[model samples]
Target: MERLKQITSLASLAVFRELYNSQTDIYAIISRFLNEIISTNGKYNFTLTEITNLLNDSFGFTIPEAVVSTSLGRLDHITKERDIFSVDKEFERTSNDVSSLKDMSLQKSSDIVDGLINYIEKKKTYV
Candidate 1:
């Protein structure tokens, strides 16, 4: 029983870690994707479907549309007009520091993970 409990706890931790890492990756991908669009075109005009397709193609993994939408919504520069989304023209990246982008992505990922945990806990209490 003790060994099983230990394994279960470790497995849970691993799952949580993967979830956090994946969220971080998602944020980084979306950031870079938007940056590429803005840099190449001087502006960004896209839709959720486009973003979702890009993510899926880049990662070769099926990412849910809701996940993409939620991530985009969290970004300050992204604005929605009906079905289309655009980035603020003035929101250009000022620094080429990869570390800063990673740090920001990690922080955002942590917040997302914490929110998910809190949401689950809240729902558990009601159940």
Candidate 2:
């Protein structure tokens, strides 16, 4: 049963990674990447050139610096200072509550797996 639970968890994680990789929206992709950076580093501070380079290396997408600048301008949660861009802490907290379909699906899958595991455990106790 423990092995089964581990397998299920690994499978769900693989599915989430597949879904994440299949995502195409440049804006969402950039936003998600920025959010990850902020989460890891405690702040997001990168110039257009740096952002473009990182995105290209991370996503294998040859995004132009101009496009990165435009995306930074469009996002309300991002602020510009000279050549650096940073995320708004307040907006970041708010945005965490906003679920895209991808997030919803991943969450639903996790819930279903957890429910199944619980049900199985209950059955074992009865037996």
Candidate 3:
């Protein structure tokens, strides 16, 4: 569509400035949806693809998936982490890291993992 061409052609900063100067409907809608998600689910549950589609249709912007993933964190309303993960899979991963023991202190296990990962990065111990 013509709108898609416009959105994709313009640099994001220019688009943002134009959007900000002209209208904030996109931001308002996104913020409202994020608030609703938090009030009902307690955290961001929408995937990047979902948000991308929403923005493309509602705001008429050809938003990139990476931008949506990062933009949520930029907004104070949405809590964003580095990446998305399956909750069940994450639990299994953490449990496995903790020697397959469910009784271990979760905090302690997390700390250990954090420390090991940080140490590796700090020392540049890469394969």
Candidate 4:
């Protein structure tokens, strides 16, 4: 019984460690993706095909176009303060936010805090 408990505890610790590492990696990837999108803002329009190619070239992630589109949608949600899509009959991508990222510097600590807060709030709302 003692040996079993020890093994179980060790396994749990290992699993936790792996989970932590994976989360860190994911956060890093997301940050990199954000940076890439910020850098190449003017190159593409609202089309996901263009965005996917740009992202794949920049990050070497080769993420599916659908995933890139979804992330862009989430970015839109987070930065809703910026009117990215005009209310016109045809949806057009506004250039406001793209120019802003170029001018504004990102504060990593604040972003991490805000990201965590957003994640928690999303979880609360959904779950």
Regions more than 4 Å wrong, model 1: 1-43, 93-127
Candidate 3 residue-wise lDDT at 22:
59
RMSD of 2: 8.8
lDDT of 3 by residue, 1-127 (tens): 6633433333333434444565566654343333332333433355667656655554345667765555555555444445441122222111121121211333344555569779999889665
Overall local distance difference test of candidate 3: 0.44
Candidate 2 vs. true structure, TM-score: 0.44
Name the runs in model 2 displaced over 4 angstroms: 1-42, 93-127
- The local distance difference test score of each candidate is 0.59, 0.59, 0.44, 0.46
Answer with 2 or 4, whichever has the higher lDDT.
2
Query: Against the hidden true structure, what lDDT does model 2 obtain?
Result: 0.59
Off by over 4 Å in 3: 1-44, 81-127
Clashing pairs in 3: none
The weakest ten consecutive residues by lDDT in model 3 span 91-100
Q: lDDT (0-100) at residue 12 of candidate 2?
A: 39
The TM-score-based order of candidates, best leading, equals: 1, 2, 4, 3
lDDT of 1 by residue, 1-127 (tens): 5433343334334433554576667555555544443444454788888877754543334668887787678678889999998888778655333334434544565666669879999999999
Model 4 worst lDDT run, 10 consecutive residues: 80-89
Clashes per candidate (backbone, < 3 Å): 0, 0, 0, 0
Q: What TM-score does prediction 3 earn?
A: 0.33
